[model samples]
Structure formats: C-alpha cells, structure tokens
Target: MTAIAVTIAGTDPTAGAGIQADLKTFSALGVYGATVMTALVAQNTTGVQGVHDVPAEFVRAQMRSVFTDLDVDAVKIGMLSRPETIRAVADGLAEFAARNIVLDPVMVAQSGDPLITPEAVATLRDTLLPMAMVITPNLPEAARLLDADPAGDEHAMLEQGRRLLDLGPEAVVIKGGHGTGAESVDLLVTQDEVVRLAAERIATRNTHGTGCTLSSAIAAGLATGAPLASAVRAAKDYLTAALAAADDLRIGHGQGPVHHFHALWPNLPGEKR
Candidate 1:
C-alpha cells in the first residue's frame, strides 16, 4: 500500500514554509501528501505581511473530509494561528484516532516574524502536545513553550526537552539549528534515552521552511512505518543535504528555501553553481 501523510497547516505563498513546504517534503521523501489549510498567509522569504486564519469549523470539516476517505498513516501539524483552530485540530485527531502524529510548534517564522498567538500556543501545549508521537521545536520555540530561557547548550537543550517530555509527548526533539555552533544539533529525548543527532551547521540564508520540512520529512518516514528515532535521523540527513544545496537556488531577496528536490532535480535551473 502507498504510504500517505497529511499536513494540517497554513499557506505559504512562497511555497517554502507551510502547507506547500510540507507537501514538497512529503513528495521528495516518496510519500503521498494531503493538506488542510488553516490560514492564508501573505508572505515571502522576507517576512510575513499578513494572515487570514481559516474558520475553525471549516478546518474541522477539512480534516473530516481527508480522514473519512484516505488511509492516512501519519500526520504533520504546523501553524495554527488561533486557539479555536488548535482545539479543532486536537478534536479531529481524537475523532479520527490519528496515529504517528508529529507536531512542529511553529510560533515564529524564519524571517523573525511571529506566526502564532500566545493563546493558541497555550492551547497547542495543553491539547496537542500529549497526543503527538514526537514534538519538534527549535530553541526559541522550546523556550516559548516552556516559558523559560532558550537552551544555550546541549545540557540545557536536554533539560528543556525533558521538561517538554513531562508535558506528555512520547518524545521531544529540541532543535539546535537556531543556536550558534560549528555543528547544529538536535536532541531526541524520550523517557528512555537522549539521542544526539548533529549535522554541520551549513552557513546559508536559505532556511525559510526548515522546520516545516523536517517535521514533514519525519511524517513521511513514519507513514512508511519507520520508528520514531529512525524517522528523525533520516529526516535530519535529508534536511542537511537540502541545506547544502540550498544556496544553488536564487529565490527571494532575504531568506530563501532549501532545495527539496536536490537529488531528484540535479540538472534543474539555478542549481548549476
């Protein structure tokens, strides 16, 4: 059977960070992808100009439309700008008994623009954190979720991850991409162990959709029945390769996007550098 994954997120006009990025990552990783848009975002690599959140009832209806017919194997959740939308998604997950849920607590955009509300953040923490197989948060996002200072080192990262684990996620992956280092590190912390996954911190400004890509990549792996840890490792490798190739694409003026099809489109335009 073909593996299928769904992304319940928002729109990114640049196709780099929200629903579009999730779908791209799914396709690149060889999984069928479905999307339920929660917002219409007017944004580019520069910054978010505006947002129009989809109604909560419509969001619920969209989830039902996908869940009732499709054999969704995994779910990748992204931006839910409103508390009601977060609740709607949480309820739909339970309603459909969704499995292999990977949640990316996206509070801020790569451009340093805020993407979610404080009220919605609280709702996501209370309602969805416990239901996910894994929750991926960058350093700043982890800090926001825990209401503490962002982890400055590996030890702090693990500590915060453990705290988040206490909130009920089976595992917490605290991303060190936002930290300063020779190598970007991510910690996969579960009740049993802490696994350190590190990659060279590629120097580039094309990281617009990184969080969405990584989370969706995990969803793609899980959709094919990979274990949580294995899925995370694979996703990391994929992102690293994508980042390495990111500079080849000349997209926006500010932060561009990772090359989702780096391997598949070797000879494509703007990649001949």
Candidate 2:
C-alpha cells in the first residue's frame, strides 16, 4: 500500500512553513500528502504580517472530509493559532482514531514573531499533548510549554523532555538549534531511553521552516512503517542536509527557507546540490 500522511497546519504565503512546508517535506520523503488549513497567514521568510483564522467548526469539517476518505498513515500537526482551533483538531483526531501523530508545537515564527496566543498554547499543551505519538519542541517552545526556564545544557534538556513525556507523548524531541553550540543536538527522549542526534551546525541565516519540515519528515517516515527512533534519525539527517544547502536559494530578505529539494536537485555550477 502507498504511504499517506496528512498535515494539519496553517498557510504560509512564502511556502516556507506551515502546510506548504509540510507538503514539501512529505513529497520529498516519498509520501502522499494531504492538508487541512487552520489559518491564512499573510507572511513570508521575513516575518508574519497578519493572520486570519479559519472557524473552529470549519476546521472540524475539513478534518472529517479528509479522514473519511483517506486511510491516513500518519499526521503532522503544526500551527493552531487559536484555542478553539486546537480543541477542534484534538476532537477530530479522536473522532477518526488517527495514528502516528507528530506534533510540532509551533509558538513563534522564525522571525521572532509570535504565531500562537498564550491561551492557545495552554490548550495545545493540555488538550493535544497527550494525544501525540511524538512531540517536537525547540528550546524556547519547550520552556513556554512547561512554564519554566529554558534548558541550557544536556541535563536540563533531558529533565525537561522527561517532564514533557509525563504529559503523554510516547517520545519528546528537544531541538537544540537555538542554543549556542558548534554542533546542534536534538535529544529524543522516551520512557526507555534518551537518544542524542547531532549535526554540525550550518552557518546560514536561512532556516525558516525547520521545525515544520522535521515533523512532517517524521510523519512521512512513520507512514512508511519506520520505528519512532529511526524516523527521527532520518528526519534529522534530511534537515541537516537541507540546512547546509539553504544558501543555494535566495528566497527573501530575512531568513530564507531550507532547501527542501536539495537531494533531488541536480548539482548546478557553483551551487551545492
């Protein structure tokens, strides 16, 4: 059977994040992609200018429409800008009995603009956290979700991951991209063990939709029947290569997106393919 993954996320006009990025990641990983949009965001790689949210009931309707027809193998959930939107997604997931849910708790944009409200964040942490198979949160996002200080070191990151694991996800991946280090590290924490995945930090300002891409890649892997750890490892490797090749494309003034098609694109003159 063909692997299918659905992305329930917002819209990014620049196609760097949200549903657009999710679909790109899914296709890059050879998974069939579907989407449910929660918001129409007027933004780009520079920053988010404005957001118009889809009604909660409409969000539910979209989910129902997709879930009924598609035998979705995995789901990658991204931005839910409002509290009601979060609730609606949670309810719909239960209604359909979705599996292999990869939750990326997106709170802020790459430009430092806030994408979700405090109330919505609380709702996501409370209502949706427990339903996720794996939750991926960067340093600041983990701190915000826990209502605690950001984790500074490996020990602190593990402690925070453990706390998040208690909230119901089978595993938690704490991304270390925001931290000051020569090599970026991400810790995958489960009840059984903690696996550290690291890569040489690429020196580029273009990493607009990294979290969205990683989560969607994981969903693609899961849709293909890979184990959680294997999925995560593969996703990390893909993202690292994409980041390394980000400068190959000039998308916008601010942080450009990672090269989602880096591996497939032909190696052109003076460009890293």
Candidate 3:
C-alpha cells in the first residue's frame, strides 16, 4: 500500500521552503506528495521579497479537487496567509473528515518574513486548531499562538505546549530549535504524556525549510500507519541526520538548504571546517 500526504502551503520558487520543501521531504521519506498552494512567495535562502495569497474560493476549489479524487491519508498545513483561507481549510477538513492532519502554525519565516497575519492567527486558534491531529510550533510561533512570552526556558516551553493543547489538537509539539542553546529540545505533549526529543544542535547554515520538512515527514509517518509519537520521533531523527549531512552543501550565497536527498545518497555528514 502506498502512503500519500498533502501539503497546503505557499510556493517558494527557490524550493527551499513552503510546499516545495514539504513535497521534497515527503518524497525523500518515501511518501507520495500532493500540494495546494495558498500563496506564491518570491523568496530565496536570504529573504522574502513579496507574497501573493491565492483567493479563498480558489483555495477551497483546489482542496476539494484533491480530497474528491484522492484518499489523502494525511494532510500537512503551512503558510496560510489569510484568515478566510484558514477558515476554509478548517471547514474543508471537517467536511471531508480528514484524519492525521498536521498543522505547522507557520507565523514567520527563517528569514523573519511575516507569513501569517495577526487576524489569521485568531482564525487558526478558533477554527483550524481544533481539527488538527497535531500542531507543530517553534518557540516563537508558540509564543505568538499563546499570546504569551515564552519564558526562554524549557519550563516555559512546556507551559506553552500545554496551553496550546487547550485549543484542541490531540497533541502539541513545541519545537525548541529556535531557542538559544547548544541543544535542541522539542517537547511533544499529549493527553497521556509528554515526550521530549533532544539532540545536540548542529552549527549549520543549511537549516532552511526544517520546520516544513519535519512536519511533512511526520505526516508521511502517520499516513503510513505510525503512531503519533513514533512518527514525530522518526521525523526528528531524519531531520537531525539530514541537517548533519548537509551542513556543508552550499546551495546559495545566504543560508543554504538541508540536502533532502542526502539519505538516498549518503556522503560525509556535516562540514568539518
């Protein structure tokens, strides 16, 4: 049986983030990738120049087309630029009763561009968050979602994760990679338990699209029948290795991208300079 995962995100022409990165990550992890673009971004490793969000009706149409034709084992959502689009997506998921929905509440980009608006955040919390199977948010994003300052420590991260759980997702993964530290710790909190995944932070500039890749990988695992915790664990391991492997590949003049195919063709992991 083949596993399929859908990514609802913006399009990055550079292929470093958004739907392109999600698709590449899904393929590398052996899952069929499908996508519906919410916006078109003119961006690169360095920064984003502009964004053009797709109309809400068109977004709904694309989602309907996909769900109508495909089994859609799982869905990963990212970069929804407008509140209407977010509401539509939430409604569509409810209409289709799609399972294994992974929501990556993408508030800002690595380059510090605003991918989501203030109004859209409310929509995510009130509309989409309830329907998500799991929601993945980094420290900054979690803070924004919770409308509270992340205490800049593990304790705060845990609290914020728990707060997000109140919004209705089955689980919340508070990514700690964005925190200032030598170790990256991601806290996964569910109704049952809190699972922590920690890894030594790799000093690499090639970390673009990491969030998209990780969420999509988790979606892939879920689509293939892996339990939520197990799926997140697998995704963390894969992403850690991918980061280590591509720490040196210079894809662009600015911060480069993690080599998604590094596992397919193993070479030296990370740059020793």
Candidate 4:
C-alpha cells in the first residue's frame, strides 16, 4: 500500500520550499503527496517579493476535500502566515481527527524573510502547536516562539526544545543546523526521552529548502508506519544526502535547492515505491 500524505503550505514558485518542496520530498520518500495551498508566494532562492494568503474558508474547504477521499496517513504543515489560516488549519485537522501530523514552524525563510506575522505566531503556538504529532523548529524559530534570541549552543537548543514540549506537542525538534558548529545536532525532546540526532553539516550554497524537506520527510516516514524517533532519524539521513548532492546541479543563481529526487530513481533497498 502506498502511504498517503498531505502537505498544507504556501506555494514557492522556485519549488525550493513550501508545498512544492513538500510534494517533491514526499514522492522521493515513496509516499503519495497531496497539497492544500494556504498562500501563493512569489519567491526564489534570493528572497520573497509577494504573498497572497488563501481565505480561511477556502483553506478549510481544501482540507475537507482531501480528508474525505484519502485516509491520509500523515499531514505536514508549513507557512501558515495568517492568524485566520492558522486557526482554520487547527480546526480542520481537529474536525478530521488527523493523526501523525508534522508541523514545521516556518517563521522565516532562508533569505531571512519573515513568513508569518506576529499575530499568526501567537495563533500557531496557542492553537496549532498542540495539534501536531511533532513540531520541527530551527534555532531561530524556537527563539521566536520564546520571544528571545536563537539558541547559541546545543545546551541552549535542548533546553528550549524542552520548553517547547510543554506547549503540548508530542515532540519538539530544535534544528541545530543554524547554530555554529562543524556538525549539526538536532535535539528531539519528547515525553519519553530526549534523542540527539547529529550529522556532519555539509558545506554547500544549495540549501534553500532544508527545513521544509526535513519535516516532509519525517511525515512520509510516519505515513509509512515508522516510529517517531525512527522517522526523525530517517529524515535526518535523507536531508544530509540531499544536501550533499545539492551542488551537483545548478538550479538558481542564488542558494540552490537540495536534490529531492536523489533517491527517487535509484532503487535503494526498502525505498522502492
């Protein structure tokens, strides 16, 4: 059976982030991908120029449309930039009793562009955070959730990840790639245990969609019946490989995108769809 996963996110014309990246990651992981566009963003590797958010009613409608047809093994959410859209997502998921939901706290972009508004942040925390099976936030996003500076070290990252867990997510992953280090260490704080997933940070300018790709990869794993920790571990490995192969092809003049199809055509052991 093909695992079916849905991604609720804004659109990135460059396909380096948002729903575009989410769909590509899902397919690469051998999961069927569905999407609900919350917004349309005119963006590239360089920056975002415009954003048009979908209405709250429309977002809810899309959710209903998808849930009614697909069992939806997992759902990955990103780029809910408005208070209305955030609330609609929470309500829609609750209405469908959506399970194995992965939320990527996409507060900012690789180009340092603010994706969500101040009001939306509060809605995301108070309303949507509790709805996720896991919430993946980088150091900067974790800091924004606490209204402080980004974690400067691993200790700080873990500490903040624990704090975020209290907000009601089943687990919180504080991405350490943004921190200063030769290796990236992601802290996974859960009710049962704290798991540290460390990987050698690859050097490349082609890292435009790391956050979106990682979260979607996790969602795909969950959709395929992997445990939470196992899902995260698999996601980390996939992201590392994708990032490593990113520079092999030139997609944009600015920061290029990671290779989502790196494993798609290659017949890897259990990865053949």
lDDT of 3 by residue, 1-273 (tens): 789999999988888889999999999989999888899999999988999999988888999999999899999999998899998888788888899999999988888889888898898888889899999999888888888886599988888998999999999999999888889999999989999999989889888899998999899999999999999999999889889977656677777788788778646556432
Candidate 4, residue 254: the lDDT equals 92
Worst 10 residues of 1 by lDDT: 264-273
TM-score, cand. 3 vs. native:
0.96
TM-score winner between 1 and 3, please give it: 1
Flag regions of model 4 displaced more than 4 Å: 265-273
Query: Mind giving the per-residue lDDT tens digits that candidate 4 earns over 217-254?
Result: 99999999999999999999999999987866578779
* Candidate 3 ranges with C-alpha deviation above 4 Å: 266-273
**Structure candidate 4, residue pairs in collision:** none
Residue-pair clashes per prediction, in order, are 0, 0, 0, 0
Q: Residue by residue across 190-269, what tens digits does model 1's lDDT show?
A: 99999999999999989989999999999999999999999999999999999999988889888999999989985667
Q: In candidate 2, residue 272 scores what lDDT? A: 38
Output the lDDT of residue 93, model 3.
87
- Write one digit per residue (lDDT tens) for candidate 2, span 158-267: 99999999988999999999987899999999999999999999999999999999999999999999999999999999999999989998898889999999988886
Candidate 2's TM-score? 0.98
Instruction: Give TM per candidate.
Output: 0.98, 0.98, 0.96, 0.96
Report the Cα lDDT for candidate 4: 0.92
In model 4, how large is the Cα lDDT of residue 138? 92
Worst 10 residues of 2 by lDDT: 264-273
